[model samples]
Target: MKHLTDNTLNEYLDHTSDERSRKSVKDHLNGCDACQTKLEELGKIFAELQIVPEVALKHDLTPGIMTRLNLETPVRIWTRTFAAQAGVASGVLYWLASQLIPFVKIPQVSLSKAVFELQSWFAQLLTIQVSLPTWQIPDIASLLPKFNYQAPTINLPFSTVHVISLTVTVIFLWVVANFILLRSRPQVQR
Candidate 1:
């Protein structure tokens, strides 16, 4: 007859033992003082485990942050505007300089002369006499009409009439476009 084992005693304490095992442990506990004392110690240990508080970590994070942004600094608008104007002026000057500069010509043999030379060489190679015909091109500048201009008298208000005509044309086009857009829109069903 073996006395109550540690596992059986633990199971009995936890109320998980079968009826027969439970009765056997109870009977053994009633006769043994040592097993009863051990069970009381285990109960006290389990109760003490319930009272111990869990510790949480607290960190000082200010030292790890090495830099901060300065939000109070103001932007200089005049400096930026000056820089933009200087860039635009420089670009315009460069463009004007390029346009004013004369183009450089490279020394090259003319294509027409080269073609004539090639034909002459081919004729010499074949020992055949080739004679190219020359035709005279007539100048048409002498036939054009010549105009002699005397300054017109500023009697008519032509500039005012021109401005009025342009304004009327623009207004007419705008009205036509608006009418077309209005006619093309989808109608709602009643």
Candidate 2:
């Protein structure tokens, strides 16, 4: 059997060879020591090529990143506030236009006249009952069916203590927020 050439060995090892060529290469490698040694050397070279080192980043990028973030935050806040104000103004204008439009009002009918008109309409469709049912006392015990009852299990962890703690926290935070806002707001001068 002829031994596999370097080119044929490489094609076989790289999985680019046809079945007949691959079988020929395998058969040659089984008998030929020199071809087997060459294959082993190629395998070692591929193994060495597969090993990759973790690369360390070289630059201090924090200051540049912080500058970009700081620049973006204020512009984002201003745009959001402007959009919100524009939306509110548009809604107010729409509401005002709807309310002030002269042709939209229905004639002012009194409550008694409206009720009488509704009753008349009902009378035309069907007879109206203007009386209430007479009330009678029922035997309260007989009215209800008796059953073996179990008390409901309420598994509340922090009841009054939790509520009080939450209230105190909310109040403290509100006071702190208000103080911050007051300090930050520009004072109007006379």
Candidate 3:
């Protein structure tokens, strides 16, 4: 029988050899003292590797990696979450407006009339005889479901101006709220 080579012994010890190769190495090892001694030395080296502990990391690298990779910072994500929340809130408010605005009693044939009239008044003061387009203002109330309930009516004046102004205010509030929300969050250190 041929003597087992160092590669064959190492492969057998590492379990990388196929069944036939391992069987051949084992058969040869029984008769070859030199190969057996080499196998023992390899085992001792492997044992020493486990006996000594692995070196610890020199420094924490996760933050540096995240920054260099241009990954989204955790703080921005958390802060911008409020923008989504504000959008949801706006949707709820619009739904409420659709529902509750119908309850307010008002008489109207057109809603845009108020805005046109205002434009005309401004034009008249400027001595421009503006042919303002006739539009329905304060008439959106008619589009809403009629006040049929016997509940105590919250009698409030309804007009295109009031609703338009409020709509603008809400929109402005949403923008400011989001801007402030992001700015108020603490800066994250890399």
Q: Residues 14-87, candidate 1: write the lDDT tens digits.
A: 89989998998888888888888988888787799889998775976555432221233344445654577678
In candidate 2, what are the lDDT values of residues 45-135, reduced to their tens digit?
8899889778887998999987777666544334554577678769978996775564344556677877776666556545433344458
Best-to-worst order by TM-score is 3, 2, 1
Model 1 misplaced regions, further than 4 Å = 54-190
The whole-model lDDT of each prediction reads 0.65, 0.69, 0.71
Compute the lDDT of residue 3 as modeled in candidate 2: 65
Ordered by lDDT, highest first, the candidates read 3, 2, 1
Checking candidate 3 for backbone clashes, the offending pairs are 110-136, 110-137, 111-136, 111-137, 111-138, 112-136, 112-137, 113-136, 113-137
What's model 3's lDDT at 46? 89
Q: Using TM-score, give the best candidate's number.
A: 3
Weakest 10 consecutive residues of candidate 3 by summed lDDT: 143-152
Clashing pairs in 1: none
Off by over 4 Å in 2: 60-190
How would you encode candidate 3's per-residue C-alpha lDDT over 60-157 as one tens digit per residue? 99999877756653334444555777788899989978878767765453548756666665665555233445883445434343332233364557
Q: Which TM-score value belongs to model 2?
A: 0.30
By the lDDT metric, which is better: model 1 or model 2?
2
Per-model root-mean-square deviation over C-alphas: 24.7, 23.6, 12.7
